[model samples]
Target: MVNKSRMNRVAAAMAVAALVSVALPGASAQAAATTPRIDLRVLVVDDGGSSVEAITAELRDTGVPYTRVQLGGSGRPVIDAAFLSDVVDGRPRAKYQGVVLPNENPFGEGSAEMAALVAYEAAYGIRQVDAYTWAHPGVGLEYTDSGGYSGQLDGTQAAVTAAGKAGPFGYLGGQVAFEDNSALVPESYGFMGRPRAGYTSYVDAPVGSGRASLVGEYTHDGRSELVVTFGYNQYQQQFRLLARGIVDWLTQGVHLGQSRSWFAVHVDDVFAPDARWNKELDCTPGDYACAGGEGKESTIRMSAADAQYAAQWQQAKDFKLDMLFNGGAGEEWKAENGGTDALTAQLVADRAKYRWLNHTYTHPFLGCIQDTTTVPWTCVKDASGAVTWMSRAEISAQIRDNVNWATSKGISVDRTELVTGEHSGLKTLPQQGQDNPNLAGALADNGVRWVGSDNSREPAQRPVGAAQTVPRHPMNVYYNTGTNAEMADEYNWLYTSRAQGGSGICEDNPATSTCLPAPLDTDTGYLEHIVPAEARTALRHVLANDPRPHYVHQSNLAEDRTLYPVLDRVLDTYRTLYAPNTPIVNQSMKEIGTELGRRAAWDKALAAGRVTAYRIGTAVTVKAPSGVLAPITAPNGTKKQLLLGTADFGTAYAGNRSAWTGPEPLQSSVTLRLPG
Candidate 1:
């Protein structure tokens, strides 16, 4: 049994160490590359429980390659005479650093398989990490005790062993939710089990000539083995953190780099109206039929909402905001009068704080063909299913005009980044999967390096035309939060038919303020519509380490009473749950674009499989494949030569490479010769 007092001291010390690393971002990746790493992969054994997929997902996400074996159900392990020989020379002959047993049954006495595993551990000094349920003599406990702890306990008590206390896996100190029916190990003491033995959350057990920290323990032939346990899969995020710590521990501190995720919000369709904003149910002149019955255009007045949004932004400094503008609106405002609107002025005044991108001059659907029969501009599709697109010159004009307008307004727009109004002219071209050369040429001429796509269509980045296309999840405020009628109308208008859905929230005529039959409950919308979307986005980003740049419209902020309150709730929840002190980097869309481009370049280079390094008496020579952007991690600043092989390939790095933010793919090979 473990000593409770010693375990408590150990946990406290370990927590401090872990926090120190978390507090200082990038500390885990700052160590010199000269440190020798243990060359072994993890062996995951599934005993038909909830942890197989969960464990595999974490391993895959973190880039920890693993071999899996189904040890449950019909394939259950049995003790036969040949089992010892099979275990001694199993199919998974790869050198395994450790094993993971999820909800496993105890390998009974005299069992050949169990004996073989014990013999292997005794010979190799490799231990096992168990999650939730496991019963083996090697685990140092039996499930013979009838009574077990249950109910909603917050976490394990602070009786962690001294070794555990001084290590990185002491995450029981972190905020975690414990569920009902969590099994208890009767043999262990302190936070893990009944208070009979010493407080033993973790124990450095003596195994043959080597030492192993037993989170749970057992013995055979006077030899002990270590087994670390996390409660269950319900506590996935917390469980993954502990799993990561265990990987680090078992591998002797060889870092399995996990990228810290980032997030941003891009507000689109921000532009000046062709005419002074009005409250009446209105439409573009000569297009009255388009507005539908009592439908209003530009109903969300930015003049009144910009200040509120600014205040909310001040409160949420860690949240990134991108203002995507339609240059035509600003031009129209300036051409109409002296351009003195409070909304535009406020945006200009706070210009330095937010990232700005181009939507277009007039915000036309660039992917759609122009309808000459319409007044200003309209899109049409022919019988052949091809949507008519604007000419290259016309597309180029939209890009250039926007850049000029934004520059004149002191809004520094990154010419390399553009979010086509409605994400038009993207990979989903009507006829050919190939992009319109005209639009591609226009973007290239305008120096646009990155274009935005939607997760609804494509969840990852792809090359389109001359620009690299990055994606975001569309967080439409109109969805879910709006009332039953409001939700129905919005969905219908977008996907099915505008005539069928009516105009929904935009139906209210400003003049009477009573055009629409039903209105939105903005108060409850955040919880109903926004919270679900936010939670999904946050959890996805956390688990996959993918960047989620959620996109909304300027009108989303103006819709209903005000969108700031809802925005506040959604962002706050994400901050608290996914990333609190160890916060995700709040980045601009352009920055995100740049990061994605670099990642692509690195991935491309890594895929070519030509990276190699060798050193003899400090004369180091490295050969990196063409187009690889990241530096190879090898023994440096010493006379020692680092071992090189395919095993080192595909190792993940946590941050961006130096100055690798450009959209252009690397085009050449790199070779380095170092002087001793």
Candidate 2:
């Protein structure tokens, strides 16, 4: 939960890779990398660039292991290929495979050495790093654009364009632009900030066969005119587009090395019972088709039986997808009389294609602000009138009951697998600790695995009754916040347009105005459109953050059980790996749910004195003094043999010293026959 902040959303496709052509000014819709191609020796040449610290910091944040070799010596011409090889050989030739030009003239102790290093990049595939340069030649870099513009490596360029006007110079603080259309980020430095000025320039992207993928234009300002774009992870389309473009132009895939991205997709409204409810259809009496209206309703609501399961084998292919997580969906509408049959067949047919997850017994918003069953729920609500959930028993019922039904439906539920009882709300009760456990704990106790209390779905926080609630961040469990609002707000035209108060608040600045920026994020759209697609995209960004990430979709399951062989393999690559791409060998959600139900029943019996427990080595004997007396008791000196894996009956001792042993499967009766 956020406090004192307006709002934000997740990241967008282009935001991930803002790869643009400096020469073309308005090309790439983004926003990457190498490792597996050729194992080339790497060298780190340093120049006195100010952002060196920032660049290093970003690399470390990734937590990916890499070797760094620093070039050090008194001023000398070390920029030649031989210089790089000599240093690499002295250390470990084969070990080195990449280069970091954190600053300019990486090959050198001097400018002459730098020229030699540039040539080496051609021979051995080395990704050179230049934080910023002028978009057009005659600006920050010496790379002459085909546009007939040539400039020095610094921003100070003479007036060769005849405009006699200086180039656009400002802080490249937000995200580097891909083309000239939009910003790489949604902070104040977004399109709302970079207006087209006389000096604003762009370059061509495919810098011919041998040159880099891009060229640039430089301005006269001390700052670099072009902000070179790079990708950390390619969750969205940006990186793939750029990589393909580069590969096509250079005719090389080997140039791209070990870098990779995790892919996944989820179905909520897209291929679930939820979509069936959107429009009324006409059918027979028992048939769901009756009302031929456009909107959904009780009598004529849509059902999951048809959308997710009603399809014939051929139609099922439409629902197939490429993904890292198979986000389980809520399709209760399919459980209806006729719908149930269809959905059951659907699950049986399609279970093989995906992993099954326990989304919820009945996908209810566990912490819904208001009950839609009573009145249409809305985000805005009166404080005192805030909605509460069904009773704990009710919540438990929904979860347990659903798991049983799913299992009965032939879905191989891994009960150890879990999804939030209700995803968007708080996972716990207002009170904390064991006795006052939250939804996650309840799910755990009940054998449901992978509980997410609250997610970054809403991505908000506020002062609630003088309390500040912060979200919990978990990798495979409770993924607190995914993306920020500022990043998400960029797609919406309203956020970019300037108003009377001004829509230009720098995210780097304090959030004093609604227009003020916050941080990198994707949007959640307006309050209206949170269809299942919303959930899928949200999960996509979350998986994108971690390279080769395994997102355990406790919420997903397949329609065909036979396809599980293949699904499991795919899941191994994407799910949590106790060992890489290996099976969990642990309990599934179905087993957990069943065991939990059994335990709950057992506990109830025990509370009624129908059962007990004991250590492995306790002995006792029961004796009756009178036939008509109550529960029998044994003398203090008596001992009883304790059996393992068996229920413990009460010890035959008198008074408070009387003890009990193991458990009761499910009985609420106890006979007491003691001597008075």
lDDT tens digits, residue span 1-676, model 2: 3321112211221221121122112111110111112221223444444333333332332211233444564664434444543222223111223344543333323234443443343333334444333232222332233322322112111111111111111101111223221234332110101112323322222232422222222222212223332222233322221222221111111111111223232222222322111211311122233345334332222133433532342143322331111122334444445455443454456665554555555555554344333322333335795434444565555567666766665666656544443343353333211111234445544664334333333222222222222222222211111112221233232223344223344322445323323321334432222222233343343322222112322222222111222233333323321112211122232332333333334334433543221111122122212111112122223332333233323432111113322212242222222222
Q: How many steric overlaps are in each model, in order?
A: 19, 103
- In model 2, the runs with Cα more than 4 Å from the true position are 1-62, 66-97, 106-259, 268-354, 364-397, 424-440, 453-676
> How many backbone clashes are present in model 1?
19
Worst 10 residues of 1 by lDDT: 655-664
| Top of the candidates by TM-score | 1
lDDT of each: 0.50, 0.30
Query: In model 1, how large is the Cα lDDT of residue 126?
Result: 51
In candidate 2, position 107 carries an lDDT of 39
